[model samples]
Target chain A: MTQKPSRTQALYAWLDERLGLTTINKLVLDRKVPKVNWWYTLGSATLFLFILQVVTGIFLTVYYVPTPDHAYDSVNYIMQGVRFGWLVRGIHHWGASFMVLFVFLHMLRVFYMGAYKYPRELTWMIGVLLFVLTLGMGFTGYLLPWNQRAYWATTVGTQIAGTPPIIGPWITRILRGGEEISALTLSRFFALHIWMIPGLMALLIAVHLYLVIRIGISNPPSKDE
Target chain B: MSSHNPHDLSRRDFFKIVSSFVGSLMGLILGLPLISYFVSPALDEQGGEKWIPAGPLDNYPVGEPTLFTFTLTKQHGWEKTAQSYGVYIIRHSDTEVTVFSNVCTHLACRVRWHDDVSEFICPCHDAHFAEDGTVISGPAPRPLDKYEYKIEDGTLYLHLVEG
Candidate 1:
């Protein structure tokens, strides 16, 4: 006859007994997740878009120069000299547009489905912050080109910021780094786009996911409730 | 007295109904796309970047700025890509020329040349740049960036920057 396992082995066996692979597989394949409308997939899509951004962004960082002087030349080199440089840049550019688009749609779906209620409120709020960061990413990324379009767009965007009361001028000054958009502005935007915004977004997204899993999926509105 | 209740469905029968319903729904959703993802790329051509010729110098008038648009293919690692860029070229004299990117310095707004004012203007924020590419009166911090240009036998060649 086969001998029984030792105490430690038995403990491991008991733990596995409580949550066995077969049982986990059953949970995943049993369709225990709610079978909601197609809107339920936007969250996963948004997450996918984020992954794309990170990947493309990393490739872009390889060739992109954060400084003002070399920024334009480097981008040109990528366009003209680098092998498949235009495609990488194009994907990065268009990827940003798609990210913003999908993120907005994701938020709208969540709102319409009443996913923001009660236990999910924090998750929704974090998502809202992420949306703002997405816009920030767009704004900052636009300036990196150092082209006429980037220059003018920054002017318009910053001027709009100047319209707000009290801290408008201060904010503008901080953003521009003096009286006008210059090297300082480029550096500031570079920092925010590459580091600050991405960092904050990652942290917030982690919290958002944690809250989502901890609270479980929110149910759709019922007639009785 | 023994009685049989026909209205009650057995546990196994109920489970069969649920399983079949879920299976059919999943099949309807995932069946087509999963197969396509595996088979599509193999049937398609090997895609890569292509260099497109922009235009010649004769097409651009002297003392007047002209917008040159071109589409170029870009390769992003394992992926293929394409995008369009617009460049504003001004021929100051026969050999002296200046090329300014159409993208505005402020926020990436496309700047238009105003012949009346002899300046590049960004209507989005009223940003202005001189004909020489200096920032004039608007919120723009710097002048428009000049592209590396070459005239080979009168054919104007411009270097495009991928962003």
Candidate 2:
């Protein structure tokens, strides 16, 4: 005689019927691949760090003010006033550094393995974009505090961006919103950091993940291939 | 080979419990403080009131209501802003002085001293006030609000009540 289904089993069945959970489980989770070493873990690690950054970032925005007048003080308040705010901001801060590091290391791994060639070329291109996006995240996030370091660092950074001949000054003007890094520049940087860069990164990441899963991870190459 | 312990909990059932428990626990831990962080600003109150110096008491001529404009450094959220304010100082004599808030009692419009009308005129609703700050006419609910003042070493200090 067949036993009755348990509550958990019934609930899962109810969800699986409508959501196609079994198809997802089979395709995304249970699919088999070639045996890989520790190096394959770096990509996943970078993705994990990005998720951590996103979580902490959403929390930080609740208290963070973007204007020049309040940016530094708001960050200072996050450090001292709000409960567990330090923890949230700390993770977002260090997670950004670690995410950038992991993205680079992951790229290095892919490069060393010759996995960027063949059917995975598109994936490699997207991965490169993700790498640049990760750096962009770091660059924009660094200037948000509006402290002395942020001010001068962005000043020099935009100046450097402007050094490449005809387009240089135009690029600096676009970034700084004027001849100097003023309140408008601060607000513009704030907008880019919180919305534009990350928004694009998130879209790229979804496509990147889809490409990785669909194309399947590349096999560990031998000298012959 | 097919003979198994029927009374034992299945591994799948055990994992379901563990996953649900761990996931809910993590959500609760992170979710509660996030709510507090966002709502903290809404619930905050400014610390207290203190005396803000308007100007020297001797500077205003007797029997004339002169405008005294000053700025207060206000701490709001993470911002410290200098908010400008205007008041009218009517010095009756050396020992007695009355300070009226320039803000109208009706809709908080700035009332100006009109020499032709001989009354403080609120441009917004045309409310008028007499020399002593009593409501002369129009939609003002009451007399103009007065600032409590204390003379210290011949200086006029306005008692500022914090919100």
Candidate 3:
């Protein structure tokens, strides 16, 4: 026959019981985790894309200049001087496009599955804000090249923003730095793109995930039940 | 509950099925690309300064402006993009050359060389520039930007901006 365990082992067992690791495991394994469809993979994919963005973005930030005069040249230097810089830039550019695509798809998945109802409403709202911020990142990054296309596109974009009602002129002036796309505008957009928007995205993502965990995953509404 | 028993797989069977499905999907998504990278020929292109000859010096006659067309091929990371630019090379003399980008200072429209008037005219917004690339009239606030150039063996080589 086997002997009884020592006092130390028994004490550790009691602590584990109080912590309820077994109970948590049962909850995770038994409590339905929505075996919906492949659409659920989108959230995990978006998270993966975000991680890729952060890594590539950090690599780019090491070479990118936020200034107006040198920003374009510095990017060129990276492309010409650095090892595998072109591949890095291509990955960054393509990754950005993919990030936007995945985010939009993720939103659609949430909508179609009715995952944004009730307690997840705030999470949906945060996701929407993150979507807009992603667009902001794209627009701001487009100007960093300082080429003719970048210059003209930014000019047209800011001019369009100036068409809004009351604060149109003020907003355009603020965006362009003086009724037009200038060096100041490039500097401002650089700051916002690299720092401001990324910071907000991180905070919003954290809050969004917190809400998601708090409410847990929503199950599909059944017709027969 | 009794009727649903046949449809439900055992826990071990379910785990086996789900894990294999997920593993295969992950492999398709990630593994194929890694294998392709090793097998691909295009992945081996190096990144460095590529010198493109814009035109022969004789093509740009003295005291006349002409458009020098050249193609720029670049590899940015994994992507290969080719772009072409028509640059105005004004041969002020045999020794002095002024290179102006064909892109209009206003809205980036292509400015044309009007031989009759001896000026660069942008039809988009009526922006005008003299043979020297200074803004002669209309909406262009800045002069046409000039590119750095060098002459070797009577051929004009221009450094195309990369980014």
Q: Which residue pairs show backbone clashes in model 2?
A: none
DockQ of 3: 0.02
**Poorly placed runs, candidate 3 (over 4 Å):** A1-32, B1-163
Candidate 3 C-alpha lDDT tens digits along A105-165: 9999899877888878999999999999988888888898888888988988888888989
User: Better model by lDDT, 1 or 2?
Assistant: 2
Per-residue alpha-carbon lDDT of model 1 for A48-130, expressed as tens digits?
77876776676677767877767887788667655556766786788899889999999998898788998788899999999
Number of clashes in model 1?
Answer: 28
Error of 3 at A114 (Å): 1.8
Task: Residues A86-125, candidate 2: write the lDDT tens digits.
Answer: 7788878889888989999999999999999989999999
TM-score of 3: 0.53
lDDT string, candidate 3, B46-130, tens digits? 4456566866788888888888887666654334579678888887656668888899988999999999999999999999999
Chain B TM-score (each prediction, in order): 0.61, 0.73, 0.63
Model 2 regions more than 4 Å off = B1-32, B42-75, B80-163
In Å, residue A214's CA in model 3 sits off its true spot by 1.5
